[model samples]
Target: MRLTQHDATAPTGMRNNYVVMRPQNLSVGVLPVHDDGSVTLVGQQRFGLMNYSWEMPEGGAPYDEDPIDGVKRELAEEAGLAASHWREALKIELSNSITDQRAMAWVAWGLSAMPIAPDPTEIIRVTRVPFGDLMREIARGSVRDMFTVATTLRAYHMAHQGELPPCLAKAMLASVR
Candidate 1:
């Protein structure tokens, strides 16, 4: 929640000064798949970068809130989609050395169109791409968001491991060649 700089003497009698950041946030990333096997992605215009970045639907949740709930809300708000099936795909410490921020990634399917209600401050573009195409873009460095990259790779692993439904996995991986 705050950053502070402090100076201290080490056991070797050496002086050290460093800045410490305290973070109190948890986030969720959702990779939504359509029944037809395409995956939903969102393009967000980041103010800091003054450029648009493509990534899975993601948002910050209060530390006390359920990650699944937060991601479900994000999917609807950012992609205008709702999913009936959900699976926890990964949990990661995002930039742990510098911040306490943690993220939960989810794979969701059985999707249907929904009303989008994005935050007024956000400008998002939603698109659907075939699973293999999405993977290719990621491999080419087009989709560079850490959360999206992690979640997509995890989903690909799940498909190969037969963790996903057979039909869906087949549809998703069909274009890999």
Candidate 2:
């Protein structure tokens, strides 16, 4: 998509009361769970007044990287885990005070948890919790990744219904917690 630019005559940092078109950033997120039904999440690099959220690892899909490749890279770079299989779980467009971008959230199953080697540029702490507690966290507002919530919920729903949408693995991931 073409990102329109303005400043037809505006100063730096000023929108000149014009249409300040925000560039859409395409990104990915992981909703990782283990065989024992435990989920892996993280403490975001940034903290909020409501306390840092427990969200899955996520990142932007680089201009040169395919969505799956970008998500794999993010998984390794952020959560310190890599996967052999990744599925798109849900789609969402998050627009609020903190971010404005299109996101694709995913679920990486048959995972093997190992040491995480996150990029120095990222500040994250990988965490794990029981799958049964997931809903509880959501209810308590502890799990912040909205995409994570959506993906996990959808995953649980699909688990019972058999199979999933073809885009089951292609998702829009986000949340504000």
The model with the greatest lDDT is 1
CA deviation > 4 Å runs, candidate 2: 1-24, 47-51, 96-100, 164-177
Candidate 1 local lDDT, 1-177, one digit each (tens): 789787978679999886767666678989998777789999989776777899999988878887788888999999999999998999998887566678899999999899999999998999999999999999999888988999999999999999899898898898776
Instruction: Provide TM-scores for the models.
Output: 0.91, 0.71
- In candidate 1, list every pair of residues with a backbone clash: 1-22
Regions of model 1 farther than 4 Å from truth: 4-16
Model 2 residue 30 CA deviation (Å) reads: 1.1
User: Model-by-model lDDT, in order?
Assistant: 0.88, 0.66
Q: How many residue pairs collide in each prediction?
A: 1, 15
